[model samples]
Target: MPALEITDLTRLYRRKGGEDFEALAGVDLTVPEGEVHGLLGPNGAGKTTLCKIISTVLLPTSGTVRVLGHDVVTDTHAVKLALGVVFGGEKGLYERLTARQNLDFWAGAYGLSRRRRRARVGELLERVGLDGRADERAGSFSRGMKQRLHLARGLVSDPGVLILDEPTVGMDPVAARDFRALVHELRDGGTTILLTTHDMAEAAALSDRVSLIDRGRLELTESPGTIGDLVSAYERVDARGVPDHVRDRIAALDGVVSVREDQGSLVRVETEQPDATLAVLRTLVDSGVRDVARSRPDLEEVYLHLVGRRGMGVDR
Candidate 1:
């Protein structure tokens, strides 16, 4: 069975004196066991709504969701048992509780006995690199340290499916690196992960395949490499000192997607074929424009192309 199976998922919220807002629109997604699936989109794009429904915190307005072959609606207990959810930031932790105490509390909630809770808590602390500071109060820990503890709390039940909602949001470079390594370790141990993030680089680095969602709709789902290749067909050329006539000529070239002038005499050309790119370069060079550079768009650029630019933050 797939680790997560979502079919025709939809959620609607009624607003006073206004039309109901659709948070998710007939979405369908399936994640096989042990796969790391990245969900990417800007704020107010329904990423959190999807996560909340899958975690059973909110009932979907419509649709069926299954975790480990158990329906989220019909088999809530089984779904909860198989799933671990970690939302980013410090809101979830108890300020006065020590790291060990916090994890123990969650482990107990998962129904682990006293002896097993003790062992599981210790193992989790070590796994998240917090064994050395297990006794420290959560409030005293750094942002990175607290995020690690959050991850440990999520694993208290040894869940088969982990939903990490922007898991590395406030982490520093080193801490983020450590957290990603831990994710890889868990995947190696056969844990399925659904990672939601606004960070394009993070999604590209960690996901086996990524699904892009926007305004409650899925744009596409593809491997990072495959997505890169799709965008690779379009290349960019930047040149300085191009006259208007030459710029217009380049714009009329076959496969040229767009040609826009930047500041002053600098011009940017976007092309969808190698021949177009070469033609653009030849036109620039022949026009005596020596300050020219050609490059391919990166993941972030591709994301903007597909999803459009929106201010980054948590989803509504």
Candidate 2:
């Protein structure tokens, strides 16, 4: 069964001196049980708005959303019982409270028994690598540490579904790696996660599949590799000392899309097929090529090719 489902979800915002605007325009998406589904887009793509509506922090203007069979609007209590949320920003935890105290407070709110709360708090502190400093006031913690606490607090309820928005924005490299591993662990244990992120590498590496959102709509939903392949990307081959005839010859080869001359005697070859890279290199070699290199498109390039060139402005 799908852990989370959204159908024709639309949200409209009214402006004080301007016309009403649609943040989400009839968007539809589903995340299966135990899957880490990523929502990716540049700022102003409605990623945050969608997440807020899903977590019940904001109401949608239209459409429906369900979490584990519970309607977010009609069954708000039941949906909240099954949902855990971690939105990347600085304000969730009470600044004056100790890390342990903060977790204790949230656990109490979840209605965990006193004994159960203690155990859960201990487990989460260790899990988030903050046990050593559990007594420190949260206001004294660094950005990354606070982010970790945000994660721990979300899971304090032991909810089945996790909604994480830009969860690793402030994490250091080491912390980021550990967090990714923790996400994998959660997925393996049957926890469903909906992650929103701008980091292309993070989305590419951690997501089972990604929904690429642009202008408040899903432009594509596929695996990272598939998204990268969606753009008509070519294997870029840079070679030096190639004759004009050789350039034409390379362009005429099967899978070779285009060829152009670069500064300082360099020839650029574009090919649709990656497997044909070796063949192109061989041809260049036969033509007495001096140097050659190959580069391929990744998720970042794909995003730029699709969204950036479309002239969509950054977050509104």
The lDDT of each candidate is 0.89, 0.87
Rate residue 8 of model 1 by lDDT: 96
Predict model 2's lDDT versus the native. 0.87
Best by lDDT: 1
Which portions of model 2 miss their true places by more than 4 Å? 228-301
User: Tens-digit lDDT track for model 2 on 14-101?
Assistant: 9899988888999999999898999998788899999999889899999999999899999999988899999988779999999999
Determine which window of 10 residues in candidate 1 has minimal summed lDDT. Answer: 307-316
Note the residue pairs that clash in candidate 2: none
C-alpha lDDT (0 to 100) for residue 312 of candidate 1: 46
User: How high is each candidate's TM-score?
Assistant: 0.85, 0.81
Candidate 1 lDDT by residue in tens digits, 39-121: 98777788889999999999999999999999999999999999999987778998799999999999998999999999999
In candidate 1, stretches whose alpha carbon ends up further than 4 angstroms from where it belongs are 234-242, 261-268, 274-301, 307-316
